[model samples]
Target: MKKKCISGLVMLLCVMLVSTSVLFAAGSKESGASNEVDKIKSRGVLNVGVKVDVPGFGYKDISTGANVGFETDLARQIAKVILGDASKVSFTPVTAKTRGPLLDTGELDIVIATFTVTEERKLSYEFSTIYYTDAVSLLVKKSGGYKSLKDLDGKTIGVAQSATTKAVLETEAKNQGITLKFSEYASYPELKVALDSGRIDSFSVDRAILMGYVEDSSEILPDKYSPQEYGAAMKKGNLALLSVVNSTIADLDASGELLAMKAKWGLDK
Candidate 1:
């Protein structure tokens, strides 16, 4: 009888020990997550990924050596909304190919680069409400007289490989019966330089990007450019974070803070 009682006590102790261990493990996980949150909150900093090469939108200022552009200002605004200090943001320059992986691996908290919103991208990353809208525009030399996609038949048109813009352009070109000789590159820098050097007849990208180049260039084509909308990118399933971002965007829109900021950055033009 004493042996039975001893065994029963041992079993109860074992069960209690197991329960305590499990509780500790779960508590540790929660604690770790809470610590991460607190770290971000305490520092009032948000790490945002942005494009470095795109001029007038995400370029480094030649004089001050600071990142200045429309998207940069927008990122700063987002940081101010979440962290209470627009200057608290740390910028991480990422290319189009690296943005998704960096955000996926937790290297970037938000992507405020020239990211376009699309149905296919909705499957992977979460996008904040559209902030700026433009269309996909084709830039050609003034001498080329390439007015539309229909004019690009058998001509080399530069585009970025793996870019959503490329796919959209290709689809539209196909639908419109425009046959283009695609010259693919990994980054916009390559494509733009190629276009400027007359390596390709034209290049297709966001209208804002083309305008940035046109504004800085001495001689650009007299052709009409198109436009597209840009959105902030974030990790999927981050409903709380996305909600906060969306709310902030709404407030900015309603208060005309967005327009004011745009004007400040010359994006309102």
Candidate 2:
């Protein structure tokens, strides 16, 4: 009977150990499953990366000292959905080259600055559903006699650094049996300055963004190539925030609010 009692106590201890392990694992999972949404909510603000130079997308208004435009408004919408207030957002200016690294370092919560989505980029970051679509085009001085991509055969085309424009133009140039040289600038304004100063024969970027840079001396060519899809981007593994962002975009799109917003900014075209 004493031996039987010892076995019973040992079995009880064994069962307790197993149960404790199961409980610990459950607790660990619950802790590990914590999402970024909770953090953003705690912070009470949505930090977004945007462009300050691209006029209709996300730019600082000189007269009003306000960050205004389509993408800026989009960030506000996300802020409203997440924080219950449209004004609870802070905008950080980002360029094509810096946005990704900033995201990696956790400096920005979301990027809404005309961030083009690609398969390769998807590997490094989480992108929301395509919010806008555009075709890559060329902007050149009107006096350059540039009617299409064919005109700048051996000349240099200026593109924003870390943008998809160069690859896009190269593919089209190859298809048209043309060899083109490319100069990469850090910002659209610099590219525009380069074009204006005869440093580059053309300024190339998405048509919508290029529209913001067009000057009296420059004209966007009639040729369009490679449809670019813009989406809000976040850090890799940020599934929680991504889901909310995607849902917000879907809800706004369904309500036709986004279409109207685009129209308000003359982007409905």
Candidate 3:
């Protein structure tokens, strides 16, 4: 009888150990699944990716030495929603080529760098509701005498590398029966310099971005092409974070803050 009781006690101990281990494993998975938003809250800071060169959208103000643009404002607004304070945000300047990868690698909590939403990108990242709409257009020297897409035939246009603008321009050119040469630059500033130096006949990008570089000698084509909706982007599978972002954007729209931001950044025009 004594031997039997000792064996039963040992069996119970083994079962309890196994049950505890199983519970721990399950809890770890649940923790991992919801950790993104929780991590941000614990840190009390939101890391936002933005462009430093696009003037009205996300650029560094020379006077304040701080980023000031529509996207910048949106990032701050998101920080407010997440952390209860708009100032609890850090901005990282990212280029078109680097934005997606940085977001993937956890270097950024969210990206608001005029990132356009597309079907292809949806596979890799989650996008918030469309916050802004922009159209692709051309910027050329007024003296270049390029009136329309047809005039771009055999001319070189400068575009940022890894951007959708080049592909959009190619499609439009094909429809117009124009054959164009494209010069790729790493950033908008490089493309702007190429256009100014006459290395390229024109620079192509979102009209709102090109508007920042427009000068007395430069002109934006009157006709806009290829409308795109801009959204904030984050790593895929973060439903909680996405929900927060979508809700914030909805609130901004409902409260007319989005429209006010557009006007403040010169996008309302």
Q: Each candidate's TM vs. the true structure?
A: 0.79, 0.89, 0.88
Clashes (candidate 2): 0
Model 1 scores a TM of: 0.79
**Model 2 regions more than 4 Å off:** 1-34
C-alpha lDDT of candidate 1 relative to the true structure: 0.77
lDDT of 1 by residue, 1-269 (tens): 99999999999999999999999998886676455445667867888899887876788887998888878888887778777888988999988788999999987878988888888888999899999886677777766766666777778878776666666666777777877777788777787789878898887777667766663342333433334567898887655567667888899899998888778666776
Error of 3 at 155 (Å): 0.4
Please give the lDDT score at residue 206 for candidate 2.
91
Ranking by TM-score: 2, 3, 1
lDDT per residue as tens, model 3, 206-239 = 9999999999999998868888899999998777
Residue 162 lDDT, candidate 2, scale 0-100: 96
- The alpha-carbon deviation from the true structure for residue 248 of candidate 1, after best TM-score superposition, in angstroms, is 1.6
